[model samples]
Target: MSGIYIHIPFCKQACHYCDFHFSTNLKKKEEMVLALAKEIEMRKSEFQDEIVQTIYFGGGTPSILQIADLRFLIDEVYLNYKVVENPEITVEANPDDLTENRIIELSKNKVNRLSIGIQSFFEDDLKMMNRAHNVEEAKKCLEIATQYFDNISIDLIYGVPEMSNEKWLQDIETALSFDVPHISSYALTVEPKTALHSFIQKGIIPQPDDEVAQEHFHILVDKLSENGFIHYELSNFGKENYFSKNNSSYWLGKKYIGIGPSAHSYDGKNRGWNVSNNSLYIKSIQENKLPIEIEILTKTDRYNEYIMTGLRTIWGVSLERIEQEFGKTYLDYLNQQAAKFIEDHLLFVDDNILRTTKKGKFLSDGIASDLFLLNLE
Candidate 1:
């Protein structure tokens, strides 16, 4: 089944390290919401024959919108698309927005899941990241949210400069104490043009060490694994039956439509994305034009994507399927390229599936790039 992703482009404030397409201005939020709904309706024919199994509201912060606004967008999806019964609807929220009444409202709505952005439960980390919420809001939101929702996921960041392994452990422990069913954690990378990068360049803040991030990842894996969490994806750990259906669909290369500026869509053969400029996107959609661009994936593009996603998840690259889909020639190239990593014990082929070893998990993306077929076979 396919899924629908709605991107909200407005934020209360900018995070220091983020470079994602968003605006801190609130003046256009109401108009933007309408444009998003219109885009949803406009793209119905793209998935006219498919059934939607998940509806994900992601953004600068989806919870910034009122529950009524969220419901209106969701209802538009239901009104236009052929949605499955009991679709998994997810909203990416921040702690500051999850008030007691907000949690109650969200729990009673079609939103069945929340991916809270509690990047760290420490005042210093919060300040460094410029997260709108504080440490107390992080813990308090989880306490109240857990009471209302069972399918909850929280975000954490690792390898912040000056954050020791012990401090990282405490962060994980605090999250564990709340018994969140899923967690998505990532290394604190400095993207060019972001405040974090500028800080590092100016010697205001030290760069996040890759070695420290690797150490933190292993700690995360071991701790969560011991607590009955499955390392379902590279950065995602979920308890049984709690894996993110919305995100899992993307890794598996299923069809999905993304609504709003800077959102992306992918079918098996082609990928599309909306304009990154919010005003342009809204204006185009309002004029009944889709402000998007599409590219047809080459065979090489598809194969490379499969390798990148395959190595990062529990489901490894299927050798037989590779041969079946892209032919034995591409399969042969993959086998030849993977031999060195396999010999290094960083990757292995088991029962026709190629998977990364625990040692190689942190470097899966790098390894996948090595396995990528640059010239068409």
Candidate 2:
């Protein structure tokens, strides 16, 4: 089954570390929403034979939109595609926008899942990151969201400069306190051109240390596992049957269509992304144009992509599938490259599926790259 991802590229304010395509300007909000619907219907032919199983509203901040606007966009998907009866409709929300009234209204909609961006429960961390919501809003949103939505996920940021291990643990503990079924956490990386990067360069804020991030990750895993959460993906944990169906499809290399500016789409063979500029996207889509660029995947490209995503999840790289799909030559090269990591106990093969050891889960990305085939055609 395929999925449709609609990118809402608008935010109340820009976060320090976010580099995603978005504008704080609400001037084009009405235009963009309509454009997104048009784009959804415009791309229906692409998924003519595919059934959509998930409808994900990811964004600059999807929660920033009105319930009516969101429902209108979702209805466009239904009009254009063959959607599953009970599709997992998820909205990535920010705490400030999800007031009790808002949450109650949202629960009445088709959206069944809420991925709240709590980031942290600490006031200092929230200020450091320039989050729009304060600590109380974050806590309050979760308290109310849980009452309405059973499938809720909260994001927590770790490895912030000056954030102690004690503080990080507290963040995890605080998240557990909310009883969110899923938690998606990530280390704070200073992406170039972002405020965080500028702050680090000017000595305003210290650079986020990778070593600290690694420690926090382990702590997060151990704590959540103890609380009955499964570390199903590298940056995601969910209780049984609570894994993110939309995101899991991406990692599993399933077909998905991404709508709106800066959104990406992958149809088994080709990958495409729309133009990042909002005005450009709307103009083109309105003029019966699809502002997207596409590139067909080569065998090596597909193999490398699978290796990167596969090792990051519970379902490891399948050796037998590799040989059957990519051929024995690629399989042999993978085994040859993985030898040292296996020897170091960083990776292990079980039932012919290669997965990372607990010691190596944090380093899976690096290991996956070493196994990449360069000129093996």
Candidate 3:
């Protein structure tokens, strides 16, 4: 089964650490919605033979749209695609946008899941990140949302400058208090061109400490595990059957269609992404032309992706699958490159599946990169 992702590229305000494609000016909200519908129809044939199992609304801020606007987009998907009975429909929402009435409205629209962007529960942390919602809004929204939705996930940030271990633990505890089934936590990274990056460059803010971040990662893994949450992915924890189907489909290299500006699509062999600009995306779709760039994956490219994503999840890379799909040469190369990590106890092969040990989980990306076949053609 395939999945569909809709990227809403507008935000109420910019977060200091965010680098995602978005516009604070929302004059074209209605126009953008129509354009998204048009694009969805235009790309329906891309996945005509596949049943859509998941529909995700991710963005700048999907919750900023009015319920009617959201319904319009959801209806468009139904009109153009053959969806599964009771497909997993999710929308990423900010605490500020999810009022009591809004939560009820979303439930009626077949939105089975809510991925709330409650980055922090502390007022100081919220202000530090320039979050649009306050501490009260964060708690109130969850209290109200829980009454209406059971499949909810909340995001939390760790390793922010000056955020002590105590505060981080408090954040985790606060989230647990909600008793949500899934949690997606990430470390604060200073990406180039983001306000946080500039502030660090100018000494206005201290750079993120890798050692502290590593410490926080361990704390997160341990706390979540103790609470009976499976560390299903490097940055995700979920109870049984509560894992994100949309995201899991992507990680497992399943086919998906991504609609809207800056969205990406993959169909087993090729990957494509739309232009990041809003006006350009709308204009191009209006002209019946897709504003996307596509690339066909080579054997090495696909192998490297399998290595990276597989190492990050609970299901580790399969040595047998490697030999079956990529042949003995690629399998031998993977074995050769993985030997050092295995020797260091960072990675281990159990029952022919190469998985990262707890010690190597946080550094899985780096470890995966080292095993890549850079010069393979």
Q: For candidate 2, lDDT tens digit of each residue in 1-377?
A: 99999999999999999999999998999999999999998999999999999999999999999999999999999998999999999999999999999999999999999999999999999999999999999998998999999999999999999889999999999999888899999999889999989999999999888999999999999999999999999999999999999999999999999999999999999999999999999999999999999999999999999999999999999999999999989999999999999999999999999999999999999999999988665
Please list the residue runs of candidate 2 whose C-alpha ends up more than 4 Å from where it truly belongs after superposition: none
Q: TM-score of every model?
A: 0.99, 0.99, 0.99
- Model 3: which ten-residue window has the lowest total lDDT? 368-377
Query: Candidate 1: which stretches are off by over 4 Å?
Result: none
lDDT values, one for every candidate:
0.95, 0.95, 0.95
Alpha carbon deviation, residue 141, candidate 2 (Å): 0.9
Can you tell me which runs of candidate 3 are displaced by over 4 Å? none
True-structure lDDT of candidate 2: 0.95
Model 3: per-residue Cα lDDT over 1-377, one tens digit each? 99999999999999999999999999999999999999999998898799999999999999999989888998999999999998999999999999999999998888999999999999988988999999999999999999999999999999999888988999999999999999999999999999989999999889999989999999999999999999989999999999999999988999999999999999999999999999999999999999999999999999999999999999999999999999999999999999999999999999999999999999999999999998667
* Per-residue lDDT value at 88 in model 1: 95
